[model samples]
Target: MDSPVDNANAIVRRHRLSTRLWHWLNALLLYTLFTSGLGIFNAHPRLYWGQYGANFDHAWLELDRFPGWLTLPGHYSLALSRHWHLAAAPVFAFALLFYMLWSLTNRHIARDLAFRRDELAPRHVWQDIRNHARLRFPTGEAALHYNVLQKASYIGVIFVALPLIILTGLTMSPGMNAASPWLVDLFGGRQSARSIHFLTAFALVAFFLVHILMVLLAGPVNELRSMITGRYRLPKPRSRAVP
Candidate 1:
């Protein structure tokens, strides 16, 4: 397709239809999983390693139960929380798989998320960090491209964090353990898998918070409109003097 009105700084297509669909779907599913998972955790707010963890065991970490507002059902009920989590888990996993395949076929992963060699250089990476610290956001054409930091974070969340969480989650399940012993062995044991799952879940929560901050920092209206409508108005080009 031809470039949309460069001189006028037109509302160019920013996100693809598949991207928009997956983004909203993921938001809803993740919210459900997070809240319900919290409710489940309220039953046992402790983490341990190895094969077994009980009240008698020395938990590496222990905490009070999450507040009612932060959990699903707004009450302590492990069984109900498990029901909500189990129902959402398969759907979330399948949606991620579908999104990954679709992104690959569309070249979205390769073209947008892949890191270029130059971007990995220490000097370049530091410069991007400094720019972000200074709130020196990209404009015009530059805004359309994913910077090294953006690419790295997106790649980490999608390829590494999401997959790890899903696999570790399955490893903690008795049925999954029975059906695929190797999966359990891969994570060392059920207790270890449980610890990893809890950690990964919070890591995703951190990412979500930062993602929201960036959206607000970079103009939520523009960022959100781009995601929802697939169109983004290009910021005016920054003037520069050539030596």
Candidate 2:
């Protein structure tokens, strides 16, 4: 892998095939979880601000319309939601297990994804915010593989929100809840679990929005190609006139 400075080259060091598969599978599972979770909420059909137990008039969210087209005769929305949520849960769990094992053994996980010590520095984060705000992406040799901020956000979503969603979701089921009253208490209550689920949903969506923005800023062709082909193509070198 000669440096582009030393040789005119088009090299590829793209994502591994397994990594790409995991990425796509994770996207599908997330989508399934989101829609099914929404469907489950359709039963209760109400939302409130503040904690779930706290009495409040602020019913800030709801999906009032049962889209007539999707509504099937004799089909229970709640049951359907439960079916999808439960079905998708195992798949999502398996993916996480694979990811955890793969990353733990391969060291690439720690090196590539984990936030570095310097990344947490206030000055570094501030610079990232300013740069991202202005849409000034890194370029050429200075081009970051990924800025420190991206690493932190990804790690947070994986470690915090994902586990919280999984645990809180299970707390809603009576049988599971019976066995695990501790989980209910951990989240505050059954209603509180629902509330946390909603909050985590919003956070995931927010992360998705930011992720897309970063990709667009990073150069779509480069980023997308790497994800698909497993080999990123570097920019073509400018031709030098023969002396």
Candidate 3:
């Protein structure tokens, strides 16, 4: 049997160097994209469906002017905001593409993020949700793997949300529309794509907020250290009573 000290000192590699690099880089790019996107949204705070929209058109969703503090550069500069947003777009897009390719080639997505068949059952999902609601986290060997909910959330963000956001963004680009009119048609029109992009941006923001909250709940030090050094110290397993 291992000594307590040995067990305490024991560490497991939880993340790869490339994964860590991409994670942090993506975090930075996302923050830039979100904030600057807000700045751009401030230029036109209304969302409309179909092809065209203007000051006189009927908008489906409209909001009061966003304060300076809520926007990038802390001021109204549509031109500057567009520059920041557009510049970050390609870098962000490429980073996501590289990460996806790496994940696929390494089988990380399949091994880690994919839900097992059993995990898809309603009972299992409900149990996981209950555990999470109770603030009960995995321990020991169980902590080595992500929970079903985590897997689902990660997969959704990686395979669905990010791709949708990227494509909708491309659809909104005039040059892209010129190059591929089919892209615009796929989304119904430029305005629809713009609305989708705005909604998806908020979805990402919601994910980020919940991610930070979970980290704090799960132990920020361990979470941060794992991402930084790829070493994670598993929690002690819960004891079971004999039947």
* Top candidate by lDDT: 1
Per-residue C-alpha lDDT of model 2 across residues 121-226, encoded as one tens digit per residue? 8998899888867876554333425677666786787778888888877877889977977888888767767878889987998998888877786668888888
Deviating ranges (above 4 Å) for candidate 2: 1-9, 48-76, 141-144, 235-243
Q: On a 0 to 100 scale, what is the lDDT of residue 195 in model 3?
A: 97
Off by over 4 Å in 3: 1-9, 239-243
Model 3 scores a TM of: 0.92
TM-score ranking from best candidate downward: 1, 3, 2
Task: Tell me the tens digit of each residue's lDDT in model 1 across 126-210.
Answer: 9999888887788777789888888989999999999999999999889989999999888888999999999999999999999
Write the number of the candidate with greater lDDT, choosing between 1 and 2: 1
Question: lDDT scores for all predictions?
Answer: 0.90, 0.71, 0.87
Cα TM-score per model:
0.94, 0.79, 0.92
Best by TM-score: 1
Provide the RMSD of all predictions against the true structure, rounded to 1 decimal: 3.1, 4.9, 3.1
- Residue 19 lDDT, candidate 2, scale 0-100: 77
Name the better of 1 and 3 by lDDT: 1
Specify the poorest-scoring 10-residue window by lDDT in model 1: 1-10
